[model samples]
Target: MSWLTIARWDARAVLRDRWFISVAGAFGSLVIAAALVALGSVDVLGVSAFGRVAATLIHLGMLFIPLIGLTVGAVWIAGERESGSLVLLLSQPVERRTVFSAKYLGVAWGMTGAVAVGFGAAGLLLALRAGTDRIPAFLWLVVLSSLLALAMLATGFLISAGSPSRSRALGTALLVWLALVIVSDLGILGTAMILRLPAWAVLVLGSLNPVSAFRLAAIVGITGSADLTGPVGLYAADRLGFAGLLGALVLILAAWTGGAYLLGRKRFLEAVEG
Candidate 1:
């Protein structure tokens, strides 16, 4: 019951699941379709218009990554718990944290591989059709955007591992995502309407949401737009520098995964012994 063994088992399970394959195919196609369509409208990916392309790719990443990650990772722990397999698996000599961490890492590896394939394919298509100007930005879109997807997946697994029931876990994950998408704007709009908040305050609220943070970060990565890369939104790489941003994302993601695993471990103990 080593960590490597646990990861191997999780990876094999995910690969055997039919749904994972379908999800990968569907998401990859959607991204490629959107990027190609955007390319058609603009026809050029010059430095002058890099911002625009970057913005489009950012929007695509924001939309697709969360949707895919949330759905795929929502059932990771809950599904096993549902069938009593989680407890059985945990009954072995392995530590609960090891099992939890290994599963999280294993699922992440599968997701990363699938996304890389799909995005890489899309990049190739864009390259072949759009010529040289768009290549660099397009490639960046593929790589950086995948990072966002991975983060969302980590969050989803956190929710799944924390909740007792599969339905509750997935519901929580979806609600969290919805809140991230709409609550920020709604809160700002409500404050603006009710309290007559200052424009600056409302703007700040909009930028603080993680969804907005990731979106802005992706956009900044793609566009390098000085104006768009305002102080708001957590860029994939924060202003602190590339190493800093990577460290930040990794820490944040690790916190979420760790939190989820701890929660799941507690739940597993309660369910079996209670």
Candidate 2:
């Protein structure tokens, strides 16, 4: 079968998966709740209520999207291997790379759809409550959030390809998620306290992780929350300018997705050949 067929099959499988449904539901609920809560507060004459909601949603996206993306991606290939479906698929005329690419696209699109539904619901609510001017900011939030999800999904695929079992792949994916989401921040805080890290150093270190890069980009680029991002944000804004920093963030996320896909494809091929 062709890669498109494989992608379609996998997409259908994702739709049937209970875990995906639960995660997507949770994401949507959270976004809707955030919008309602933000609206409860009074909007100042100049301040945009949609902007506040979008900022809150960005933080929420940072937490939720990566976890969901990783879970979906980790199971894509490893689950097939566990069920002996990978072998059957390989027996077909499809190239290994095609299979891998198809799986990635399927998972990526599935996760992106989930995110869009959640965030779109929130955006619609915001548009109703706030002015239409906020639509552009909401759109930017959607694009950046999708980019972050794809990056995390790529990392999950890498873990799945390298793991021998579905369980191991899942365990590794969780660990990777924890490292990027929690441990990395703690380490940076501790190191900064101990070493009195320079602003440039903090920016450099933060940009290394996709999650952190997403946060930096959202806060600095979309929300204009330079104060919240601290000196690192200022450094980025000063050196790279807002447009340049955004360009760099996009490049970093793209690199994460592309590099992980290439590496994962190689490992998947090796596993099938062996």
Candidate 3:
């Protein structure tokens, strides 16, 4: 009946899921190990240790953000619904909106924590190895990483809520991820081929993809450089500054989350009664 009650239940459900813990643990360990290896190979003495640390965190965080966000979050609710547990939970005295909000908060918070651990582990290793390169970027890394994670989780939650079946929700989520990562590049390539445009044109279009923006944001935030040179990379270099790209990512992600929620809100209600 109460929002707090639903929040508690949602938290309990997420905590009990072995899948969430297993994936989080594996990812966190792998990222931390990779960062340590990188740090060991680089020369840190008399170098900007703070900058190295920041760059490392951002670099590693970029790879994991979307994976954690979409892959893990997408299935949270849809899986429950497919298993018939979501309906059983809602059939309790809890309000539907409250149930949705609580579940969102639980999963979002849980995911954010997982990402923080992964990034934090990487940061610690960098510190131990590099002593610190650009410390300021650490602040940016934390804030941006959290937002990135939230964006992923929220999008997944929305899709899960709206889909008629778990398979559909997961398929759509994976498709969206693929489109963000690889499809955008393919689209640019296809367009450039058909249009016979200048090389710069292809470069520009690829940079505009949200995934490119996120990658550039991570690079710029950590290294204080944007070296986009080949295909989509070059376009990113020309189009976005460090701040501009991050701002764009925030805006685009917000739109995705908001739109998903709007659709989910309607779909959940319809499905509940049906």
Candidate 4:
């Protein structure tokens, strides 16, 4: 079968999976709750009501989107291998690269759609209560959040491909998620505090993780809150400018996704052949 066919098959499976369904449902609920909280807290501040909501969503997205993406992707290939389905698929005429590419596309699209739906609900709420001035920022948040999910999916897929079993893959994925989402930020904060890291060092540390990059981009781009980021955000804004910093974030995400895909593809091929 062609890659498109494989992608469709994978997407269908994801849609039918109850785990994904539950996650999507919960995420939508959370998004709606965030919207209500933002609306309730709106005041005559320097920032617009919509900006505050967008900021809230950005923080939520930075944490939860990657988690969902990684969870969805962690068992993708390794689960198939564990079930002996990978062998059957390999026995078919489909090329290995095509399979990997299609699976990646399917997972990425599924996660992206989930993020869009969740965030779209929040956006509609903002538009109804606060007007459309922040619509552009909301759109940016959706796009960036989707990209972050895709980046995390790629990372999880790489772990899945390299793992020997589905359970191991899932474990590794969780560890990777913890490292990127929690440990990395804590380490950076501690290093900056203890070592008196320079602004450039802090900026570099923040840029190292895809999730951190997403947060930096969202705070700087959507909320225009450079001070909230402390040294790293100011350094980036001063040196790269807003547009340049955005470009850099895009590049960083691209590297994470592309690099992970390449590594995963190599490992998958090796696993199949060996």
Candidate 5:
């Protein structure tokens, strides 16, 4: 089987799904709405209005994109297995790896498309209203958000490969999201506070979370200074600077995406052969 053909078919299938459509629509609406809301934020002398919008975009994009990628991906394999479709598909002439990789490609394309539309619309709105000075930062928001989505997709795909049913995959996906996005950040911060960790140490702790990696990149892009992120930001600004931090955070995300996909692929292959 041509993996490209399967990938394209899967992308079309994802686009046609009502749940994905609704979620993408909501994400797009939120992006535009966030830009509009950020316009009301007070702009300091040196900062462009679009910079403020980028901040809001970062928060909203990070929050929702992970949900979109993970929840859908979590069911990609498990749902088919539960319905007995996966067995039928595996019996075809196509190799298991083709199906595994192709499905991921198709789904990734769908999620990436959604992220682009949402962030692109927000960027355009900001450019029109606040001028284009911060367009680069807005672009960074899109790129970082897309990376985070892909990383989350990899994680959810791993979960799907091992899960027995859609319900369990979904429940597990939610817990993963909660742990990475919410609990990890809060727990790290509280630990830093109680331990009186230095700014550099807090920065290290934050980078371990994928969401925080995206946030670090976003803060550097939008504000041109990590100080906007408070104490950790302050240290990042002095020690690592923009290029350093952005590169580091992006690498972290890339590692997660690659590592999870490799593990998921191994499990999926075993599942097919079993």
Candidate 6:
């Protein structure tokens, strides 16, 4: 079958999965909760009303997006292999690379749909409650969040490819999620504290990680000033400029997502169809 055909099938399957609704609902609830919470708060360091909620949601997005993206991706190939579905699909005339590409494309679209609902709902609510002016910034945050989700999903593919079974793949995915969270935070802190790297150097190193890059970019959206993100932000704002920082963050995110997916696909081919 053609790649498009396979991708359509996989997208449909992923979107229709039982957990999909729950995922969407979780995002909606988070937005509503954050909106209500923002109303009670006095100030988020002088950020606009929408900015306050957006800032809170950015952190929540960082946590939720990666978890959902990685977990769903981790289960994808591993579950298929464990269930013997991969073998059945392989029996078709399609090439293994085609299968991998199609599967990822399909799943990416499925996930995009779910995340759009979540982020979109937040934007809509903010527009109604806050105003339409900052909608552009929130929309930009949505784009960055989508990229971050894709990056995590790509990492999950590597986990699923290397793993021999679904449970192991899922477990590995969780450990990986925790490692990235811990390492990205402590790792940055350690670099600054132990290495005594210059602020510019530390900011550059921090953006190397997709999650960090996303957070840094989101900071601009929330605060309209990267300097508010702390010293790293201050350094980047002075040395790199906002345009430079955005360009660098986008490039880093693209590299992580593309590099991880290609590497994972190669491993899957060797392991499953070698």
In model 1, the clashing pairs are 213-234, 217-235
Residue 234 in candidate 1, Cα distance off native in Å: 13
Candidate 4 Cα errors over 4 Å, as ranges: 41-47
> Against the hidden true structure, what lDDT does model 5 obtain?
0.84
Please write out the lDDT profile of model 3 over residues 190-252, one tens digit for every residue.
Answer: 888899878667645654544555555666655665663344443554566556655665676
Note the Cα lDDT for every prediction shown: 0.65, 0.84, 0.67, 0.83, 0.84, 0.81
- In the predicted model 4, the residue pairs found to clash are none
Quick one: ranking by TM-score, best first? 2, 4, 6, 5, 3, 1
Model 4: worst 10 consecutive residues (lDDT sum):
41-50
Model 1 lDDT tens row, 1-274: 4888888878777777676777667777776676566566545543444344456556666666676677667778888888789878888998776777788778777777777787777667666655567677666666655566666777777677656777887788778777766676677678778987765565456545545656554554555543464443333234546555434534444454455456655654455556
Worst 10 residues of 6 by lDDT: 39-48
Task: For candidate 5, write residues 1-274 as lDDT tens digits.
Answer: 4788888988888888787788888989988887877775534433455666666678787788888888889998999999998888788788888999999999999889888987888877777767777778678778888999999999989999988999999999999999988899899889988999887788888887888888887787767777677877777767876788778889999998999899999999887776
| Pairs clashing within candidate 3 | 48-133, 49-132, 49-133, 50-132, 50-133, 50-134, 51-133, 51-134, 52-133, 228-233
| TM-score for predicted model 2 compared with the true structure | 0.94
Q: Count the backbone clashes (under 3 Å) in each candidate.
A: 2, 0, 10, 0, 0, 0
Best of the two (4, 5) by lDDT: 5
Q: What are the candidates' C-alpha RMSDs?
A: 4.3, 1.7, 3.5, 1.8, 2.4, 2.4
Residue 251 lDDT in candidate 4: 84
What is the lDDT, from 0 to 100, of the residue 254 in candidate 5?
Answer: 96
Report the C-alpha lDDT of model 4 over 60-113, residue by residue, as the tens digit.
Answer: 787787777787788889889899988888888999988999998987877788
RMSD of 6: 2.4
lDDT tens string, model 2, 1-274?
5999988888788877888789878888989998988876626533366667877898788888888888878987898889898889899998889999998888788888888888888888777777677677778889889999899988889989968788998888888889989899889878987999987887878888899988887777666546667777778888988889888988898899999989999998888886
Better of 4 and 6 by lDDT: 4
- Which residue segments of model 1 deviate by more than 4 Å? 40-54, 132-136, 192-208, 229-274
What are the runs in model 5 whose C-alpha is more than 4 Å off?
Answer: 40-47, 194-200
